[model samples]
Target: MEHSGKNKTNGFLLMLTLLSVIAVVAAPFVWDRFMEGQTGMIALIVVEVLLVIFIIASSHSLWKNSGSGEWKLKSDKKGMRVYTLKNPGETWLKIKIIGRLKARLASILTLMRNPDAADDVGMFDSYYIDGWDPDKDGVDPKLVYYTFKQKLFPPFKHREFVVKSEFSQDPVTKEMKFNFVAAPDKLPFNKRYHRVTEMHNRWKYTPLENGEVEYEFIYDAVDPGGNFPYALANWLIPAMLPFAFAKMPKILDKEKYRNAKMDYVQEVGEPAEAMA
Candidate 1:
């Protein structure tokens, strides 16, 4: 099944590449024949440039393996390290973060299950508009959430996403994984916000002997819709991750999260010992 999916993807990428190349080659001639003016010439050039960028970005994103790339260390601070990979022909960078936090797995899971609770922490208050479980009924392990958020900076348009989130623990290793992926066609389109169509992220937590939880975060890729420049967005996105992660310890220190306990999640040791 997986191989079939890959073959389909490769075929699609090839078709897109051929079409893009043809368009790029034919654009100037079409402009010269049909529209012969300075303004028309400028528009033709813009179209050609955009088409080229699309071809490169799309081809790289679809064909290249997400994990198979040279990653450069971007930041190391407060026990967290951030790495980024700029794949050839891609406009945006893939990011990965590894860190150790003085928190329990249950507490982390609690936060993931209730992301809107972060609004009280003030960090995401302005950005997070709302979120809810689509099923309405309370369920364990798997949940579909629809989240609406606004950009932190200007051109503060809203972005909506529906993602299927799941929590799983390895029986042997005891490591916990929280995975999220874009859920397509789950809800009707809303005119209020731009719907984000592509996103895949995962968080892995490994309990250490001394009670600290070592965590790794992977952001595969995301396409923030609208006219935002991909280059600028890529730069700004990575710059914000460190700040967000540095605040995690403090956020988890809150009474609600610090004292959290879940029956589904197994802690490394006693909460008191871990906190101490």
Candidate 2:
């Protein structure tokens, strides 16, 4: 439920911005009544001062909150850490953070927000390479992302997020977390970071306590295969998203017995010999 400093700040600012606009638009209405009046002049000055004061106060808050909540991606030299990790089974990238309270809160927000939209099948996620700090800023391991392969990745950069699940006798709750999108100007590191658009869904098949094979759903997004490479790849993997959704359930149920265990088939060699 916690939001990143970046997201919370922006969300807060968005509300402020909207209100400012409303004030500006309504200024004329006020002017119509009070134009040329002493009262109008006093009111106008007060409003202008209040707006300026609000902006200044917010900027100051942002500066104090600005260390890492989301304004920009800082490199190690700037005290931010970086890292990248890949396993045959799992591919993830992460960043580390030291001791900024607000920064830590922002970090929490990021962890929760990433994989922003992964379902039982797949998700959309993003993060910097674990160790490639352009500015030497510390990175949080939790600030890692995944790769999703498709003919064409979405035009925008994805996000970071997480999900937690609970089970019960007859009812259970599934919880998910998310963070705010990075403002275009706030992404401090690389534009593409030499990465390409990518996405994927984790397929799982597990036998339930009831002798049925139930599955756990998970998803992630990654950067890989540029337009040219994807073109050559023949759009094969990317095109499967729809099919992934449609057939995932069927794939788990392909066999009539979700939990049927196999014993053994008749021995072909011995049986054939016996028949002969």
Candidate 3:
């Protein structure tokens, strides 16, 4: 877990590094050209589209194969890595519960992060879980809610459980969301849910210097005891501040609270202690 936290901090730093380069080196060129052609309606559209793509690519889970199996995540580092456990034949894998950790992972936000303003598939502030499926021939412990949610049943083919929940509230957008996507169309399964019953908590140590750390206690909501959703939440999650600030004018001194140090979080590491 200690090493995992370090990895997350590293990955976030890498992401921030990538964005800073984009801003300091790339933005001026693009902005200059954009302003010159600002009067052209299509040019403005093109620039906006480019910016949106740039933001999404920075803040969401795009996939690649890792080791023996496929991994779906924006970064394979801790605090921001997602893992979806697959069925291993007759052997059932025992997964440690880290829902709280997963939430902490995605909850950390940085000033460098730009909110995803281009996701038309679904819209929300935090993690977005869009798909799910159960009893798909090889799944170890099948999920009942997804099984029923995707049903073609004779009235008596199912059972229901009473479920309950509290909420994760994002103050900036005044949004209350409770789930994060696990498979995101990149995995074998076709269903999704929040990583757990509770919302993941994130701590932003430095919001001013555009550096920070995050932790998440993600629930394995898709398959209560399964590893897929929990893994996916951690690996794929990214900073939500970028999207939240999409429409607003950039104000480093005033509108930098979310990106500022997260005093509400617990001590995990000194990686983000250098933020200004």
Candidate 4:
């Protein structure tokens, strides 16, 4: 539980780092677009220098977490670094309950992936608004598709992708794996410029000794999108990592909470629903 809180804090820090970087990078562009003629070249140079300083300061402040936990996240200028951690003490009991939780979890994942899914959670500030998913496929077992119309600044752009997906659980190892590969289709944007062109997403849940479970999530892509916003977007997209990683712990917590309540009811020899 203590570790969970620390992991949450790390996630928040990563988000702050990304937001700070975005602000740092976008300010000069925004200023040039709005006040280009008004501001002299010298003034623009000064602003650019100040922007560099701000970026340095903000990035330093946001990524300076020194917490020890089962959750580890590491990112660098090139891209997200490979890090792995496991949540120990997760039992594979209650098959029916676990199955329900998995289904609900998949639904939640669909909501997260589809930026136009009403945005009830408000996960992204600027996201797809139009007919991104005309097929109405929520979360398919064989294939996953997405067509994105995203607006970060003045203009809105479209992004489309299809993934060949597989979801399976191993009874022997008690590991559940979800893997996907980008389809070989002509993308809306250039393959060299787009961020998600050659995308491959791998998600796994492996139960360890002592009733613990280790989660491994790997997201691989050619490019995230075009250079301007997509460059920053390459960093921003992974900010949602902590949120995704935290969900399973939460689901397990719910199961534990429910079982504890049921245990108390059994101890008292009373019907739980009737009591309510």
Top candidate, metric TM-score: 1
By TM-score, rank the candidates, best first. 1, 4, 2, 3
TM for candidate 3 is: 0.21
TM per candidate = 0.66, 0.24, 0.21, 0.37
Badly placed stretches (over 4 Å) of model 3 are 1-25, 28-30, 33-37, 40-45, 54-61, 64-95, 98-220, 223-276
lDDT of 4 at 36: 60
The predicted structure with the larger lDDT, 3 or 4, is: 4
lDDT of each: 0.71, 0.35, 0.32, 0.45
Q: Candidate 2, which segments miss by more than 4 Å at Cα?
A: 1-18, 24-204, 220-247, 251-276
Score candidate 2 by TM-score against the native.
0.24
What's the ranking of the predictions by lDDT, best on top?
1, 4, 2, 3
Clash statistics: count for each candidate = 0, 52, 52, 8
What lDDT is obtained when candidate 3 is compared to the true structure?
0.32
**TM-score, predicted candidate 1 vs. hidden true structure:** 0.66
lDDT of 1 by residue, 35-74 (tens): 7789888889888899999998776576453334688898
lDDT of 4 by residue, 1-276 (tens): 996897787677667657656765777667666566755556767766776676665454433343232444444323224443322222110000011122222333344344444233332332332344424556333334443333344343334444555666453564556675676463344432233456666766555554444555665554544444432543555555545344544543443232332111111222334321
Q: What is the number of residue pairs that collide in model 3?
A: 52
Query: In model 1, how large is the Cα lDDT of residue 154?
Result: 62
Question: Over the stretch 182-210, how does candidate 3's per-residue lDDT look in tens digits?
Answer: 32223233234322222222222222222
Number of the candidate with higher TM-score, 2 or 3: 2
User: Tens-digit lDDT track for model 2 on 128-193?
Assistant: 333333234563322333332112346533332222211111111111122222222323334443
